[model samples]
Target: MTEVFSSNSELVLQRSVDINLSDSGSRHEDIRELYQISETCAFITSNNYKKVALQFPDELLVDCVAVSAALEKETNAKTYILGDTTYGSCCVDEVAAEHVGADCIVHYGRSCLSPSRRLPLMYVFGKRPINVQECAAAFRELYPDQESHVIILYDVTYSHAIDDLQRLLGDTYPNVVFSVLRADHSHGHACEPFKVRTNSDCQDDTFVHKFGRRFTLTNFMMTWNRCSFCSFNPDTSTGRAESININKALMKRYYAIERAKDASVVGILVGTLGVANYLNIIEQLKESIRKVGKKSYMFAMGKINVPKLANFLEIDVYVLVACPENSLLDSGEFYRPVVTPFEMETACNKHREWSGEYITDFQDLLPGGSSHVDFTESDHSTNDDTTDVSLITGALRSSCLRSSPEPTDGSSSSSSVVVRNQTLTMANTNAAASFLSGRSWQGLERKLGEAPVVKAVEGKRGIAIAYEEEGTERKDSACPDHKNLNYRKQSGV
Candidate 1:
């Protein structure tokens, strides 16, 4: 194919591996330990599962067969290895497992630890080596103050080393706490125990429990539960690492929330189908947008990308309902800003208070969850018209809601009326309809019976670059009206 058609070509599918395995006794033992074969066998045998699915990411597919054989030998159950998940590999592929009628799933590799509502789940986080002494020393260097309140969070690959890290730094830093991962979920309550780690016996009032972690701050007068989140980034030049400041990221999300508030049309991007309570969250978002006098459109385009979301030109903002790991989409590449469910709630819910605590999991926004703030549907009825300057466009932002005139029966319509900045007219509460009304193209006209039906016929015969007739025409005729005749004859332009 020519260079012009190269853009239409597709790359060959190939599985790449970074791990090197050798034939040795120690390597076999390491495989069993890394994949958690022993514990998985016990769980499958105890549950009496006839068929189980072993899910793996692309990078880990090399050992899927070995892991499956080991499990089958020990548990006497048929195993299926599932790869290339429909969505993020972090969440359980329940839909794929259900196709095989799997009694349960043993999810391998990294995970978001989201609850599985349909099928039982078991997570086998493949172990990765981590130097305990190095991690402890880095912790001390970053936090010179021994009394600094810190809650260390790690990837699932480093989970096996968390205990060693905690033990090494326990006596030195009493305030430092390390998170532990829960592996077994044979029972229905797969995600309950992992919600938050707090000490009920501690009488100190300075500590706050949120985001599934508990810690305290020395000063409490800055803001309400204001916490700073940081992560370690390896410095290749110095052969050292430094903590990345997440405060800037938090500020950007807050800016996104403001942009969402100013938006007239909101798009809810469903990034996960296997996550629990996803449908409920989508509906909740639609209702919340309606209550706040904004319009919402739900989209289920799998694996979001720039071009896919760019096709919908009407959406001013998007709220992605995805796993915790994939929830915070970098909207810098997108045409519009993308916010998480928590940011959506804060922008729409009048009763919700912004305390600067970021929540990535949508479950935390649902009732009975940790971050479910105290609010009711009735709170939306009361009009708290307010105006402020937008941080994004530097324009006046208004939330002036009004109701239509009372009917002759002395009853009021429940629909709320909102003011638009451009029109300055009493518009309908539905922002979608109002947005479409202002657009130049309003889709195909529905003149139904008035218009005559037409039959389909072929038109263009070749690609847009060169049509059939244009390509078959004589070279001399092709340049009949060209400004540069000599150039056209040489290059056939």
Candidate 2:
């Protein structure tokens, strides 16, 4: 059974199956309903090529399938599947197109006889262009303010078009701010400077140093929003200056420590970013350390250009500071210490104060004209036993002190050595604790042999303890009570 209706009306199909095919009355009713729905909808073979072969009494399916395919090819220049199988056998695709009131079904398939001759098929499928235009207009209306600060952050591949886009925007909108950033493989282009430059006149020298050659810009504009933008200035000059000052202060502190110990080797660990500022301080201290017959060793870490500076300074040890997350001094060819910025600062200060006495002596010998006095001569014999006892006791105390060991995971130790001439200065205690357990300096006879005598002295500041080796002395302001060691066994010089 089947029924036919006008294109405007709705058609619903229903089917009931009977176990007894012999029942003619029930079969007739089902056929009638099926026919009525088919008449209105038009059934074509679901297969693409065979669609035209299977047709309804009205042949509307043939026309509808042809029209939809033609429209797809002409407008989108694309092919679309059609027929009962393609549209779920219900002619739904044709029905949707009809509802949208499209006209002209150009059957460009085998039905047209000449398959090679392609024709312009425009109808329902061609509405995509118009719809897309409407959507773009709506988006523009919603985000009118998006044109304030337009930044085009793009990949290297898209970098070529950045200048073009910027120029286009500038010519289109003169008041608008426009900028383009070509992102490295990291996906994050450093845009902090561009953001600041867009809003203010301050130029960011660091940003320029980091990205000048890689950056490109065209005429400026004020109406494009192709990239991320901010209204903040990114000038870090003031911050860099502050960091330099901090580095200098720390350098002075380290100089004092070297002087007190008369140490030939002064290890300076500098952060990558702070290297420039610290180099100057190192130079000044270098001359002073030389006068005391000491050599200065400078180590650089972080993202600093050490080789460049090393070339300028005539230094041999130029180590590239690895990332703190994974650091190792492979062969110790260079001073590759895995230290953070904070630790560097602490070590710098400690080294300086530890060698303060030598610094004072060097200063006393300056051009002001002072008689050279030999401090080790007369005073040495008077305090012999007392200095020896003090040195032995301080060494024993330091040896007895124990700290827990850290897990040995093949990582760099975070320990540092501390020693004051003639005093028990705690060095590498925390560092040792982190690497070992149930251990005291007493058990380490080899280290005891290497341990030098400690010393305590009275300077203008106050009383401080110092560690004394064969020709050097190291002082610790924190342990002033420790006695000074005899000059023979505890001299850094």
Candidate 3:
């Protein structure tokens, strides 16, 4: 590929990685391998889409223009470049495509491949070369205790080199088990050989059938959901030993969901704007929250991190609705609980009993064969009968709230009000404690009304203020003590 940089080019963000820009535009190894021209051409030709939207993640922006120019020339289609996504780049930028009326999106770099609702999407997971010979040799040296059948696993970016890896390993390890990820052709993201740690050994029709039925993220461990991804059967003697790792992963997720039960406010982190059918998922989430009577806030951000979310102190938990791959944001590191949509359902939905089913893809959380949540006829028609009536209904205070406690040097008056509010908050806290104290919520407190509330005790000056409920009328006198009047003036209170 040629070094086609216009006058106004995006400045290089990182120094380590650089795309070798060619002079004559014939194409060099670095650019050609990263951007597969043949496959891209075939995809564009077959799709018959005219105006293509080329969406690139931040890291791949350097090669975006060069790749776009090539696609336009080969396919004779007008190209529009889309910048920073509102959510995680692994999600398709469906929001950005509306601006240019894009016929379809050619997404480059990391993607979760969530089913899109509107425009079709194609993923170009740029090829990153891996030394298959060295890796396999290292693997053989590392684990000698295991049987000859070793599950070859890797990140999806290095998936292109899996074949080369298998060939090198074939010499020593005769029974090398490899898994293949078949595409759901319904969405435009059907770029082949999408190996998320597995690819078809491409042996025969019998081999594929014997190994698997439907390759699905839904019902991850169903009877039909074959361990064909890997030949090691957990039921058999060999399968039992390998199953330990899978068990640990599921347990970790289960505990994470359990921890979310104590959370007061839930922050819905919109991880993908480009993903197709997020609106439906969000509705289900809001209704779920409503059913549980927990407050929900939605946030749409480009790059999500601890600092970005730390600003919202009130939010007790966060649920990321991004693509499954990008959503692996470690829960261990975050200050608060960060869970997936499926995990949120586990946490909030009372009837949703856990059966050790781990589903990262949000679509899998839906009912039946569809890609999204399917609410029943009863769910759609029926009104929410249960109204979450707050237990403490009338007011937060023990006595009637006054407009002003007879103003006396603004701070004292405001501070007195603050103290009263604090008193009410304490009462409310106590009320809430009692509200959840017993099996019947001790309906006693709700029926009997406010408890003996704590009121802030007035001090002469610079003295420790104690909380008391007695002598309420005597303290109501707004007239300042003449002795403290001069003191109050000097102290500027």
Candidate 4:
């Protein structure tokens, strides 16, 4: 019998491969040139971090052990190869890092720039070669003369391409603006896409802005894909830049939810585990569904694909809770509608209007956000198993609820109780509401400075403040700060 310590952390071997790194021809070249090798080793060596966990995605996992050993030898650091992530590999695996007492995580491949609470992260976005000269040539040729400020946004993997494009375009189009969009590395915050800057140093009055988001381009003179750096015009059957019709793009997102609002059983798909505070957001989602008076079941899977999701035919819609890059999945080819939590909120809540503004970052939807968009319950009621109950009840299912849609089997009775003495679980929206209303506590990772510190207030409900000091003004029942109540402390009130 092999020695396997814990069931949860057991290493499941599919098959074994025996190959020498030095002996292999093309494989040796490929593995030797694993992106940013010198820089990564130097960082580890300089920092003197003894134990490091190297996280690799499936695509880059080919040289996992080889790279890990190399790092170990070069930096004299103990390296742990983390293959299977609990959530999306884009986020840091605090769980895996803590398992091995790793001082830092050397994350390989794509990253969502998700805040890491415990383990400090070092990202190595493996360099993927792109046709930078060709893309720059296409940009100069196809772009309309009217438009000037061109903000080139791309994934970090294509950082090499952006660097090259910036150099080549500077010679001809001196006035045209270009920015290599960098991910916001600020802890506990998602950065904005645009910033109009008027540099006083420059002689011209041209405005510059940075974009870190991706969009599909079509039906215009120019279109560009952020990931592949491929620019195209789908309508004219020619290729160049991206043309985004703001109104149309917004409407398309809105319409997807209209289809989702018609779903009965909504599935909450967990897309990222590596991101800090994912569990908190999932809890918030369940509560939102409860408030809307709908049935919500959560599915936690590593990689989301079509066939894996098709197993749950009962769910009419899927709300993907993932990183900004991976969250908004296309639902056109899927069996049913798949949308983000923000879309899920718009679809289920009656009072929440879709005014074309969309949110990709889940952090914005966090329950206690300062600018959290409040949504009122819908009174609409639906007896149809395929439709969302909240859209039907208008949140009318408070105590005595009624559904309008007839049973699918041609039941003569319109009453929600039964068609022919058949009791449905979803029929009692109130019951489902109560069942889905609680939040489970997963351990949170907050900085020492950021973590909330609780203090016993004499005359009012217990209060917690980020900074705990005796001299600092203490919040009391009469203080203005008292208006903000800690909902966590409330016992069913």
Candidate 5:
């Protein structure tokens, strides 16, 4: 039996491995340079910041203590290390930093580049080695046309090689562009607001400064794929650039929007507590859902997973409000379809048309945001008589609903029943409530006075791990002094 259990079990115990640390001066210098410890110290001393918070993602937590110690020693200012983030690594945990009364935050590792509202932020993009010449050659080969308008964006890790690649690629491709690293800017929120500009050559080619860089809206926009080029083995000849099929991903997102349109209950999943304007977006989403005559439920959770979401059987779809990088959840494994705020907006507004521009950030959905579009609210009274074919289930679905009709006989109360073909039918306007009512298991049932009551009796004592029975003798008895007490009583003392 033990062998069988062991064979069928999936758990595997991993052996611990010891890593040797080098205390060499060169190694220490590299650490300081890579994390920009000197620059951070300068910023702290110049600003006279008393309390500084150092936020690092899970992967770079190994150097959290070292980085904090170096900063404290250099700046002579108290430093707090924020190892675990409440949301994601990209957005600054202003709430956590506020707990420590930190005036400034120095974020490490890859960030979603979302602007912080509370405290000023400094980004330290650790350098990752890359051969610029080789990357340039690869780019040229992939985009053979010298006139191709390409915007090259990269991960923060490979930010060091961007400038070099820009110079190399710029000489060949006139329209080629590169994204500036966020670390190049002092603070995100402190930077200037987004400005709209147009190029002289192409008046239609608009320019918007965002994500710590200026980008031109041209024919082709190249976004950096996390699994794409930049991370390559120096020894392998397979090359650096790995092409990702973006169209397929967009199609899946569009399908999710269609599914959202058919849903009767929309669950708004609050995935971030740190990002700015999250509360505003949540309220807006609730209003939008109400306007569409659909039910909306808000879920406040730490981390999102399949099982956690599957627990809510009532929710037909979920709209995740999170940072741009983490908002687009691939819901292939989830029981219900998970979509972004942008998709939800499109789904709620029947008049809105998708311009093929996928927005991952909830911030953009807010009023005065870049992706915000003005649309007239649909009249639910008129919509009650309208119906549409569901793109998902291929069933006819109601558009919206108005208030229940007044009693035909001018009575205050009315019956929610209709007689059709000599049979009575219940008219349920609330689709979600009706669906829950039809479920076999409608939660725990309190059958009051159904089962007969039994007399109370002494139950087994002790903890669950080792319960004691009435017949079992406890060696360590509580009355160990019983013999002495009996002798004293016999002596009449």
Candidate 6:
């Protein structure tokens, strides 16, 4: 009895090894590396078989084929796969069972469903007919003592099988889980599904609280997969939301600055596809700015294939939302600005509060849209003086220690200027401000502050002075008493 149990266990392990050897890819390489150092078990499919098979060197392939053949010949190893056998590391089953004389073969596919005499003959002589549910249940039963973790891998076509497996393994088995692997697999060929295997102990309380309540009893598991893995993962939905929030905050700050005095309308342009979802939010942001007495504009640009419902009313900005592919095909050129998600996030966070040259390149992709203003040209100007003063003063005010400089000549007409020779000093101040405000300053503040300072020359149009703040010598071109100035002097004030 002990020998029989040992043989069966070795056979199962050998089958697993064969499957791993057959399916090799970048992911499989990682799996192989992981298995080398840990007790890892892989659950692969025919879809991923090609990828997995390519990972093994030619020498290893020969070794695997020979080992597989020997194991099938020596043991009662039953090979059961749930897809077309024409593909997947070819000749493994034939060479193993026939050449080496293996025990059993179980191939399940659409052709096996026929009621013809050949179908029954194949069922009795070659393979067994088992539904996906029955296969999953059998695996569960076979490893009753082992803490088996089952992942139901299926494509969009066999989504029904996923549902069936989920229903079969419900609350009855706490360890069992289901995941829909989204991939296009044609003709029931063996394909590997992208598996997002979350450890059972890693409970997402916030996810459960938010999406769990919305899950229906009939589709609880399916909905849970959609929410946790598909829609709401931080890499996908949450990241997009963060971008919107950052943009809104920046737009609000821009409005507040403009509202202090009338500034020219600055258009907000958002790209399509991934960034288009924030169109409504950007419009709302413009409205919020308008309410605060600021002139603002908005432009959404992307492919025409983008949904038409993304229209916004009462926005001063021109929106050119359309598809890049269409634009390229129509005009014999592909012209679309691709902004990194990180850049979008940074633009949103610092757009409003930090005063510097703000230019989003997505604006240029729109039809009849002008190129984005160069940051080098805009940052060189002294227009950000008031903005800098406000940032500095705000920082001082928060600490309850007024850093506002007294007028050197006691002239209210004179502008107060803050200048730091070293970019690090400005960076430190900006970081300190962000830390104090409990909000990130976006990339604008960091870049602006870290930029090398060009000292104002003598007889220059603007005032030049160096003031000591927080043990650092800061230089500025703005007059010391010009704190109340609405716009920076360089912005054509």
lDDT of each: 0.68, 0.28, 0.57, 0.59, 0.66, 0.29
Whose lDDT is higher: candidate 1's or candidate 2's? 1
Residue-by-residue lDDT tens digits, candidate 4, 1-493? 2233233323345554453332222253465465556777877787778998888876667678778777777788898989878766667787788899988887776566666567666777755545655565556665534345444545555555555667787666656655433345442112233232335332223222212223322211111212123243212223433344545666677777865666656788988766767788787777666554466788987677676777665677889987766776667667767888888877655566776456777787776753256653244444222232344335522322234344588764323355335563435343334434543533454445554556544333334443233344455557655433333422222
Write candidate 1's Cα lDDT for 1-493 as tens digits: 1112122233334544454342111354567878878888888888889999889876677788888888988888999989878789878899999999999888876677777788888777666555667666666666667886766665665567777877898999887666666644445324432422547322322232112101111111112234444344222111122223446666777898999989988999988888889998887787677666677788988888776777777899999998877787778878788898999999877678777666777887888888786445443345556677887799997764433335654544443454445768675556566767899988877665665545544465444455556765333465654332121111111
Better of 3 and 5 by TM-score: 5
Segments in model 5 whose C-alpha atoms lie over 4 Å from true places: 1-29, 181-247, 378-385, 401-439, 442-449, 453-493
Q: Rank all candidate structures by their lDDT, best first, as comma-separated numbers.
A: 1, 5, 4, 3, 6, 2
Give me the displacement of residue 207 in model 5, in angstroms: 18
User: Which of candidates 3 and 5 reaches a greater lDDT?
Assistant: 5
At residue 248, give the lDDT of candidate 5: 67
Superposition error at 25 for model 2 (Å): 77
Worst 10 residues of 3 by lDDT: 205-214
Better of 1 and 5 by lDDT: 1
TM-score of model 4 relative to the true fold?
0.58
- Point out the worst 10-residue segment of candidate 1 by lDDT: 212-221
State every prediction's TM-score relative to the real structure: 0.70, 0.19, 0.55, 0.58, 0.71, 0.20
Clashes of 4: 20
TM-score winner, 1 or 6: 1
Q: Write the per-residue lDDT of candidate 6 for residues 1-493, one digit (tens) a residue.
A: 0112112345655673333232222233442232221110111222222111111223133333433343234333433222222212111222222332322222211111111111101111111112655444454444353334443333222343455556666657666555544332232323222345565532442121111111121122222332222112211112111112334433443443322222223344443322222344354434333333334444443223212212322222222322221111111111222222112222222323344223232334222435222112232232222222233134311101112235666654212233345453322123223333664433434344545555443332222343243344444456444322222222111
Instruction: Assess the local accuracy of residue 253 in candidate 5 as a C-alpha lDDT between 0 and 100.
Output: 77
Q: How many residue pairs clash in each candidate?
A: 0, 60, 8, 20, 1, 41
Error of 5 at 436 (Å): 5.3
Error of 5 at 45 (Å): 2.2
On TM-score, the candidate that comes out on top is 5
- Tens-digit lDDT string for candidate 3 (1-493): 1132232233534345433332112343555557776677777788888788888776677677888877877887788888677776666787788789888888876555566777876777766444555555555554443344444444345557768767876676655565554665676755433343434423221111111111222223321222423322111212111232545567777767765555557888887775655666776776575445465778876678766676665677888887766664566656677888877887666466777645666765655433334322343223333322222232231111122235554564322124446346322232223335544533434323334444445445321232233332233345433223112221112
**Candidate 2: where is the Cα deviation over 4 Å?**
1-147, 151-158, 171-493
